[model samples]
Target: MDVTPLSLARVHFLASLGFFALFLAIALALAWVLLLFKIQARRTGAPGWTAAYRLWVRLFALAFVLALAACVPLLFQLGALWPILMERVGNVLGPLLGFAVVTVFVLKSCFLGVMLFGQRRVSDLAHTLSVGMVAAGLLLATFWLAAMVSWTHAPAGAVLVDGRYVLLDWVEAVFNPAMPWLFASLVLASALTGAFLLVGVSAWQALQRPPADAERMAFRVGLRLAGVALALQVAAATGAAQWIAQAQPAKAAAAAGYWHGGETARWVLFGWPDAAGQRNRAEMALGRLPDWWLGRSAEGGQLGLDAYSGMLPPVAATFWSFRIMVLAGLAMIVLAGLTLLRLHRRRLDPAGLPRAWLHGLSAGTWLGGLALLAGWGYMELGRQPYAVYATVTVTEAAGDIPAGLLAGSLAAHLALYGLLFAAFVRMTYHAARYGVVPVRKAGARP
Candidate 1:
C-alpha cells in the first residue's frame, strides 16, 4: 500500500488539533477543581452537616461528571486512531492497543460512577477517593497516549509475524527510548497550564474587591503552586529539547530555520503560513538565532546533536520555544505573587497597590495564556511533515478521508465547542464575581 505524503500531512494536522482539543478539555476540568477547592475553603466555618455543604458537594459531583463526559470523546477518538496503528503495526499490535483503550475506558467509567453515587454513603472518604481515582485515570491515559506516540518515532520495536505485527517486548515497546523525555514534557505542560489557570482565577477574584483574610490566604497558596509549576515547566522544556536533538533532528532543524543547504530560512513568530516565499522565508529568518545562544561548547561547537547521523543543527527553534514558555510562565508567577503580597500587607482593602496589582495580574494572565498557546503550536508544528507518532507521514494517514466530510465535521465541532467555551467563560466569570454565598458573622450563633 503506497501512502502519499499529502495524506500523512493531513493526518498530522488533524492529530495535532485533536491533542490540543483534549488539552483544553482537561484544562477546563482542572479549572473546576480549583473553583471547588476555593468553595470548600470558604465553607470552612459552616456547620459540618449543613445544606450548604451538601450543595457544594453536589456541585463538585456534577463537575466530575462533566469532566468524565469530556474525556469520553477523547477516548473514542484515540480508539479511532487504531486503523492507522494497525497499518503500521500489522493486526496484532492493533488489538493490543485496543485492549489498552478498553481497560482505560472501564477504569474511568467505574471511577466516574463511584464519584457520582458513592459520595452520600462514604461521606468524607468520597472526596479523597474521587480525587485519587481521577488522578490515576489521567496518569494512565497519559502513559498510554505517550506510548503510542513513542511507537510513531520508533517502529522497529515491533515486527510483522503471520501477517500481523507483534510487539516483541511489550514493555520496551510501550516505554520506548523517547518515553522519558516525552513524559517529562507532558508533565511540565500540565503543571504549566494548571498554574496559569490558578493564578488567573485568583487574580480575577482578588481584583473584584479587597480579599477577605481567607481569600487572601487562598491567593497566597495559589501563588506558590504557580511558582513551582513554572519552575518545572522550564525543566521539562529543557528535557524536551534534548530529546528532540537526539531523536528528531530533522524536525528540530526545520523549526529552527536550519536546513542542509545554506539557503536563507525565515522565522515565524505569528501569523499563519503563506503560500509564497513570504511565510516560509520569514519563518526561516525569524526562527534563526546565534549559535552561542543555543549553547556552544567551550570550543564554540553546537551543544545540540546534528540531524544527520553525525551532525547537529543549530537547535534554534527549540531554544526559542523554551524561552517563550518560560518567560510567560515567570511573568504570570510574578503577577500572582505580587497580588498575594499586596493582600498580605493589609494594603489591599482600601486601595493603593491592590488595584494596580490586579490590573497587572489580569493582563499578565491573558498574555501568559497566549504565550502558552503559541508555544504549544510551535512544538506541534515544528514536527510538521511528521505526525505526532512520527511513523505515519501526514499525507498517507489522512488523504483517504474526504475533504468535504472532514470540513463538515469540523464545522459542527467548532460550533459546539465555541458555545461550550463561551458558556464556560461566562459561568466562571459570574461565579468568581458573585457566586460566593455570604457567610454569617463569626460570633452570631444561629
Candidate 2:
C-alpha cells in the first residue's frame, strides 16, 4: 500500500516498458519497409516483386497487430509509472502524445486497412497511395515519439513557471537538439531492422533448394535494402554518437566505459567496465583513434563520467549494449560488403545467389536487430535514474503501485507476447514456404 522510491520493483516496471518499446521499434520498421516494397513494385513492374508484395502484406498485418498490443500498455505506463512526469509536465507532453496517437490512427491505421486487404478491391494507384501514406504516417508518428524521448535525454525549450515545467516554445521543444540526430538514426535503424529480417527469412526459404519464388524476390529486396542501409547507418550512428557526446556527456562516457575523468582516451575494442574501480578489465584499446573520431577539436578531447555532473546510468549495461550495437553495425557492413561483391560479379541474381552469401545474410539479420535493440537500450538506460534528465528522477516519478501487481503484470505481458511471437513466426513461415496467395485462395478451390 505504501509508495516506494527506486527499488528492484522500479527496475522490473522499467524493463516491461522497455520490452514493449522493442516491439514498437520492430513494427515501425516493418511499416516503412512495406512502403519500400510498394514503391519498388510500382517502379519495376516485376512479377517476382508483385508476389513478394502479397507475402509482405500478410506479414505487415501481423506486425501491425502486435504493435497495437504494445501501444496500449506503453501509453498507460507513462502515466501509471511516472505520475510526476505526466502530471507536472502534462501540459507539454500531453499534446505530443495526443498528436502521436492521432497521427498513428489517421495516417497509419486507416490506410493500412486498405493496404493489407484492398489490393484487389482498390485501383493500383490507390493501393500504392495506401502504402505510401501508412509509411508517412508512421514516420510522422515516430517523429513525435522520438521528440518526446529526445527531450527526456536532453530537456529543452521548457521553462519552470509556477514551479512546473511549461512549454515556452513548442516548436523548439519538438525540434530539440537531440531530435534531429536521434530521428535520423531511428529511421535508418528501422529500415535496417526490417530489411535484415526479410533477408534472413527469405534466405532461409531460398536454402530450401526448390525455393519459394516469392522468397527469391524478397531476398533480392532485402539484400539491396540491407546493403544500402548498412552504408548509411554508419554515418547516422557516428553523427548521433558525436552529438550525444556534446549534449549528453554522461551517457557518452558510460557508453565508452570511460569512468575516470581525463584527456587521453582509448577506444575499447572489448572489456568489462567496473564502475566501482573506475576502469576496465581485460581491456584492449586503440590508443588515439576513438578520440580522433569522436572529438570536435583537433586536440581530440574526451570527458569521462566523472567529468559529468549528473548521476551515471548503470555503467555495465551502457558499456556492453553500446559495444554490442557497434559490433553488430560493423558485422552488417561486412556482410553488406560481400553482397556488393556478389552483385558486381553477377553471382547475386534473384534467381540464384551464392549459398554461403545467403547464409551470411541470414546470420547478418540478427546483427541488425541486435543493433537496433541494443542501441535503443544503451540510450534509454543511459538516460536512466531520471525520467527527464536533470529535472525528474525515475525514483521520484514512479507511482504507489504494488510490487506484486507490477511483477504480475510484467509476467502476463511477457507470456502473451511470447505466444504472439510464436504465432507470427509460424504464419510468416507459412507465407514464405507456400506463399500467401495459395493459402488465401485455398478455400476457393472448386
Q: Who wins the lDDT comparison? A: 2
- Give the C-alpha miss distance for residue 242 in model 2, angstroms: 1.6
**lDDT (Cα, tens digit) per residue for candidate 1, span 1-446:** 45434434334344445434344434433533434453464457434223322323343444334444555654444444334534555443455456556755775577656554554455444555564565566566556656665566655467756534566777777777777766666655555554454455556666787654544443444455566656676677667666665566554554543433333333445332322222234342365554322333346444332323322222344446545755676676566555546555663332345566666665554444445555655555455445434445443333345555655555665566566546655665665566445444345677
- Clash count in backbone of candidate 1: 29
lDDT per residue (tens digit) for residues 173-236 in model 2: 8898888888888878877778778888877777765565567666667778777877787888
In order of listing, the candidates' clash counts read 29, 0
Would you list the C-alpha lDDT of every candidate in the order shown?
0.50, 0.73
Candidate 1 Cα errors over 4 Å, as ranges: 1-85, 90-109, 113-120, 160-165, 260-353, 364-376, 388-391, 436-446
Highest TM-score: give the candidate number.
2
What's the CA RMSD for each of the models?
A: 6.9, 3.6
Cα miss at 367, model 2 (Å)? 2.4
| Cα-based lDDT at residue 7, candidate 2 | 53
